[model samples]
Target: MNSPEQVPQDDDAEVVEPARPRRKGIYALPNAVTLAALFAGFYAIVMAMNGRFEHAAVAVFCAMVLDSLDGRVARMTNTQSAFGEQMDSLSDMVSFGAAPALIVYEWALKGQGKWGLIPAFVYCACAALRLARFNTNIGVVDKRYFQGLPSPAAAALVTGFIWVMDDAGFKNVSTMPGMPWVAAAVALYAGLTMVTNVPFYSFKDVSFKKTVPFIVIVAIALLIALINLHVPGMLFGLFCVYGVSGYVVYFMRKAKGKPVSVIATSTDEPDERGLH
Candidate 1:
């Protein structure tokens, strides 16, 4: 605290303390985007409850897109704030964590009775754990590779399966032979993957502002066309590949006898544990 000082104006003034300025309030734009993402996640859950699984899946995917944009927009606009960051994390939990778990459970797991709830709860819990770990280890972890499957990607993996099956005219997961079993496996896999030590590509090194060759643009165009051909199947397949890519990295590292940890340094996170 600042010590009170006396003014010597007329030798008759009492001492007074200086007033401190108030801290700034939260930013508007980034937080607005974060709230929109949160709303999308909430909408997905609500839709799932109403038996609109396809819409729910779409809503979760929408949340993922919006979640990705909020951070970039905040950074680009110079509006990044602690409030925005926290809001983003919370939004992600709802969007990529809880929403996917609930939606998938409603679509498939609910059919398996109590057994179905196990993977959903595990996934939800793992997502929470993963997000907490991410927040605490922001500067201590590797940037090019995520320590585990990202929550958004995990959410995408589950939601994409729902979208693909729903689009294929499968009215329910249990009706399809082995679909419920497959979905349960996906849930457990995605959930467990979130808390694993396996390295998944972060794509952080891919800079948007950097110049690229002409073929890169053409390739992107072609990619868009391919996706347009079959949105659900293509998206699900992409996320499935990404979902398992972490294991591929882990096995590759193991085969080479390299230290497979994703944390920046051994001392940085001595307690770091992941599935090898």
Candidate 2:
């Protein structure tokens, strides 16, 4: 046997460090909400396929509502995560981007051959581009304004049109004179607007934590009553106004000689070119 102090350890014996406990599965609540939103989008697509355009529209709208809640829920619950952010983005692409495009096409654009397909494709593509840009520029963007029309709002505009028209008995109006063009116009407007630099108010600075006047609560009740009075028409009309509000703000800022870009101006990091 070797001397005790100089004894050679068995070369084959291995030291095994204790394995770290796998991190607990990602925070479930927010991601579950995201999954629910994604399911709404999927349901919308399925409803469109089944010729239930009205139901499809409603599902898309539901997705929009859920999508809006996920981020706020995550923030409020202190469970924000990179995974949740990405999950939200993917869910949005399906709900707002793909679902709306496909639903519009099935509801109106299907009969126009390439004319209809082109605008639907444009809208979907622009949605993807807009989301990508938003992700990349998140750090440099103004929190008070979105650099482009938000995907949820865009989905709302597209699906809202379908809902109002369907409610008005315009179901499958692909053969109705000028209707396809009208659908195409709405699709093109919502789609192209997403890629524009026009800044839409984000409403992020509206803190729910602050105390508000009694009138605000009363006004909210009135607004709820107004919506309940004529759900489809009122919702569509509201979103329609919002769709053009960005242009109004952009032109107003331009005419007043104010910077129209929503990107933060910085000399120290001056490399964010073409964002405007």
Clashes of each: 0, 0
Q: Scored by CA lDDT, what does every candidate get?
A: 0.88, 0.89
List candidate 2 stretches off by more than 4 Å. 1-25, 267-276
Most accurate candidate by lDDT: 2
Per-residue alpha-carbon lDDT of candidate 2 for residues 175-197, written as tens digits (9 for 90 to 100): 88898888899999999999999
Which candidate achieves the best TM-score against the true structure? 2
Per-prediction TM-score to the true structure, in the order listed = 0.87, 0.87
**Model 1 spans with C-alpha error above 4 angstroms:** 1-22, 175-177, 266-276
Across 201-241, the per-residue lDDT of candidate 1 in tens digits comes to 88877998899999999999998999999999999988989
Worst 10 residues of 2 by lDDT: 267-276
Task: Look at candidate 1 and tell me the lDDT of residue 185.
Answer: 90
Q: Model 1: clashing residue pairs?
A: none
Q: List the residue pairs that clash in candidate 2.
A: none
Error of 1 at 211 (Å): 1.1
